[model samples]
Target: MKIDELHQVFLNYPRVCTDTRKIKPGDLFFALKGDNFNGNEYADQALEKGAAYAIIDEEKHTGKQKILVENVLKTLQNLGTFHRRSSKAKVIGLTGSNGKTTTKELINSVLSKKYRTIATSGNLNNHIGVPLTLLSIKEDTEIAIVEMGANHQKEIEFLCSIAEPDFGYITNFGKAHLEGFGGVEGVIKGKSELYDFLIANEKGVFMNADDPIQKEKLKDYINKYGFSTSDTKYYQIRLVEANPFVVISVEDTIMGSQLIGEYNFTNCCAAVIMGKYFNVHLDKIKAGLEEYVPSNNRSQIIEKNGLKIVLDAYNANPTSMYAAIQNFTKIEGGTKVLFLGDMFELGESAHEEHQKIADLAKELDFDNVFLIGQNFYEVKSGFKKMKSFDDLKNHLTKYSLPNSTFLIKGSRGMALERILELI
Candidate 1:
C-alpha cells in the first residue's frame, strides 16, 4: 500500500506498538525484525491482542485485518515521514555520542512550558524508535524533538532522511561506539552526518560555540550558544556547579537545576539557548530548567546510610567518564571514593581507555578507587580491582565506608547501580 493509505490507517488507530505484549486496542502494530527475534512471527499475536491492524512483511502472516508490505520497517518509516510532513510543527533532529536523551528532555521541557511539545521517550531514538516518535506527534504539537542514536556510520544520515528535521544539533562528539564506528576519526565523521543534513537542507544548527570541534566543523548557518557573550554571535552561559546538581547562568538568569555533573551544564545550556532562540520567554525557559530532574541512574545523587552517592551508571565512554571524574574531584568535601567499571565497545582501544581512566583516578588521588570488569582488571593500577560484580559484592561484605561520598559509573552492561545495594 502507499504511504498515504497507511497514514490514513494510522490516523484512525492513532497509537502505534511494536511489542506484541504491549499492544493496546486500536493500536497499529508494525512487525520489526532484529538480530535475535523477528517481530513478524508475532504479528498474529499482536492482532489477537486487540491491535487494530498488523503491518507485516512476510506474506504468510498477511490475512484478515493484516496489511502486507514489501518491508514493514521501511513502510513504517515512510508512514512516520508522511505523518511528519502533514504536521506544521517545527522539528529538531538531535543526535550525539552522549547526552542525547538528557538534551532532548530539556528541550522538550523548555518547549512544553510554552507550547504543545513532543519528544522521543527514554532512549527510544533509533531506526524504529525515531519513526514511532514522529508518528506519535499530534497535529496540535507545536514542536517535536526527535532524538537520534547511531552506533555506526550512515545510521544518523538514514534517520535524518526519515525524520527530516527542520533544525539539528549534535551534543558534542566523543569516544563512543568505537567498535562500530572504527575509531575516533570515524566518530567525528559519523556524528557529523547531522551537520551534513542541516547544511544540505539550508537549516540552522544550535552550535556550542565554546566547543572548538563544533566551531571548526559547523562554520555556517548556525544558531549559537555557549560561554562568553563578549563574542556577540554566541549566547552567554556559565557552569555554576554540578557537584550536588547542575546549576547554570544563562546571561543574567541563574537557573538552579536538579541535574548533577558539571558535564551536564552544557546539556541544560542547550535547552535554555534553544528555548530563547525559538522565542520561548526567558521566565518560562528558566522554569522548565529548574523543574527538570535527572533519573535512570544518569547523574542522580542518592543519600543513603549517611553516604552521598553520585550515580551516573546509565552508560559511559572515555569522554563522559573523564568529565564525571573531573567534576567529582572538584568537590572538596567528605571522603571521595571511586567505583568505575569497564568502558565497552572500544574495540582494541578498550584496554587503553580503561587504563586511561584508571590512571586518572590514581593521579587524582581519590581516597580509594574500586575498578570492576575484566578490561579494568587487566589495568595495572594501585586502585582496588575486581573481576566482576560478584567479586565486588564479596569484598563489600567485609569492608564498608559509611561517611565518604562515592562516584559510581560504568557501561550499562556493568550494572554499576547494583553496587548501591551493598554500599
Candidate 2:
C-alpha cells in the first residue's frame, strides 16, 4: 500500500490490532499470517468478535468496512511508519543482552511523570511487536520509549529503521542468545547496530561506560553518557541497606533510592540520564523512578502467609544470575538458600558457563543450594546441590526452619518460579 493510503486509514481510525484475541469494538484488525497460523482464515471471526473492520488478503471474503491487502504484516509496518511521521515524540530505543526490558520499564515509569508517554508492553520488542506498538501511539504522545530486542545479526537494525530513534540506550553487553547471535562478539555486533544507527543519525547514545566495549564504540559520538572512568556523568552505588528498602545514591548529586542494590542503581541512572536529556525535570525524573515497581519476577520482595519470598525467576542469563547471587550475599546474616534452575540457550559454552555459575555459588557460600533441571548437574557439582525441584522439596521438608533469606532464579524454560509453592 502507498504511504498516503496508510496515513489516510490511520487518520480515519487511530488504533490497530493484529491479534483477534485483543481486538476491541471499532478497532481495525490486521489479519496477519504466521508460521503455524493463517490469520486470513480468522478474518470473519475477528469482525464477528468486535473488530470494526478486517484487513484480509482473501478476495472471496468481503464486507462494507473490510479491506483487501496483499500482505497484512507488511501493511502494518508501512502504516506504523506513516503514523511515526505525525508525532513529534522523541523516540528512545533501548536494546542489550540483559536489562533492556527492565530499563525500558524504568525509563517509561520515569518519563511518564513528566510527559505523555507510550511504551512497549512486556517483551513485545520484535518485528511484528514493534510496528504494532508504534501504531498504538496516540496523537498526543510526547515521548515513546521503545525496547528493541533480537537474537541475531541486524534484527535491531531493522527495528531501528522503523522507529528511527532520536536517542539510544544499551543497558550492557553480555553472553545471551548464543544459538542465533553465535557468541558474545556476535551479540556486540548485533546490539551495537543501534549505537551505529544513533551515530549515523547524529543523535545521542547512553551506555554503561564501565564496559570497555561500550566506551570504545561510543567514544566518537558527540552526545553520549555512561558510568565509567571515561564518563563525566556517572552513577555510583554508595550503600545497600537491604530489606524494607535499598539505599542507593547516584552520581553524588542525586540521593539514594528505595530500590535495592548497585545494579538497580545503575538501571535507575540510565533512566534518569536519558529522561533528563529529553528535557524532563529532575524532580519529575525522581518521582518517576520512585514510582516504578518490579515487572514480572525481576527482583520483587513479597510476603505470602507470613513467609518472605524474593522472586527473581522471570528469565535468567549468566549476567543477571550473577547479579542476583551477589545481591543475595549482601543480606546481612541470614540462612540464605538458593533455588537455581538451568540457564538455557548458552550454545557451545553451556558447560563452562554452568560450571562458572556453580563456582559463583560456592564463592558466595549460600547456606543451602537446590539445582533444578538436567542441565543444572554441572551447577550441582559446584555446590551443595539437589538433583531437581522435587529433591529440593524433600530436603526442605526434612530440614529445620530458619529465618533466612531465599533466592529463586532461573531461565524461563525451567519454570523455577514453581519452587515458591513448596517454600
Give per-residue CA lDDT, model 1, range 272-369, as digits (tens). 87898789998899999988888899988888889988899999999999999988987655899899989999999998999899999999889989
CA shift of 268, model 1, Å: 1.4
Q: Would you estimate the TM-scores of all the predictions?
A: 0.97, 0.91
Candidate 2 residue runs with Cα over 4 Å from true position: 60-64, 227-246, 250-258, 378-401
The per-candidate count of clashes, in order, stands at: 1, 2
**All candidates' lDDT scores?**
0.88, 0.77
Candidate 2 lDDT tens digits, 160-249: 998889888888888788768899889999999999999998887887777888878976666776654344566443443444344544
Candidate 1 displacement at residue 276 in angstroms: 0.6
TM match of model 1 to true structure: 0.97
